[model samples]
Target: MDLRRIKDWTLLPGASIEVRQQGRGVWSGLVDAVTADGEILWVIDPSGQRRLFEKAEFYEAWAIEERDGFHYEVTKNDDNLQKVS
Candidate 1:
């Protein structure tokens, strides 16, 4: 799997993603919701734990996609990752 830096994209519900901050792994889970204004993100983990993160400049979001015979161009998100510091 390759990770691409996104500059323009939106987080949609039910998508799987790995969030990184300052070159470190943060959280990886299913997206629950993103505020209409695009300033906040909510994700649900395997244990049904829901967490909220605020948009920040240091956050990076990479959408994990599987493809080969089923390749997909990951939609990029310009908005930074959320608050968790």
Candidate 2:
């Protein structure tokens, strides 16, 4: 029931996540794919780059869950992202 632990959440492609380090925006976008073991996540940043992120120390991933009154959608497989109200 908190952001500290999201292991229970099923991370899927197209999910919105904004990761940051040292109070700076690293990157945020719709998830493109996830490792089979769920240890890594691949996201397409705004610059059209495929970046890999691992849930570990010094990393914070923000997910706009249903309770947040917002959601994200990937219009197409190309990772066209849109935040829905």
Candidate 3:
């Protein structure tokens, strides 16, 4: 799915998201809050509380892809990015 498609679906609390920060690596966390400007605030597990971050900082959409009951790979790309909320 693309960024526009994901953003179209409301991302609320309790939703799991794979965040790939610049030079910080990837992590999965619950979405705490989302800004009107598309900035996402979430908490990293085993790290205490949540942190604020912008959506534009993400290099790609990270998600688990499974095929034939086996783990395929973690995908990333810029094609999923969009400007609107």
Specify the highest-lDDT model's number: 1
User: Which pairs of residues collide in candidate 1?
Assistant: 8-76, 9-76, 9-77, 54-82, 54-83
What are the clashing pairs of model 2?
Answer: none
Task: Provide the lowest-lDDT 10-residue window in model 2.
Answer: 1-10
- Candidate 1 regions exceeding 4 Å error are 5-9, 66-85
Deviating ranges (above 4 Å) for candidate 2: 1-5, 22-24, 65-85
- Tens digits of lDDT, candidate 3, 1-85: 3221133212444455555556344665565666554455554554656766566666322322211322233344455433222
TM-score of each: 0.62, 0.54, 0.43
lDDT for every model? 0.58, 0.57, 0.44
Candidate 1 clash total? 5
The true-versus-predicted C-alpha distance at residue 75 of model 1, in Å, is 14
What local lDDT does model 2 show for residue 6? 35
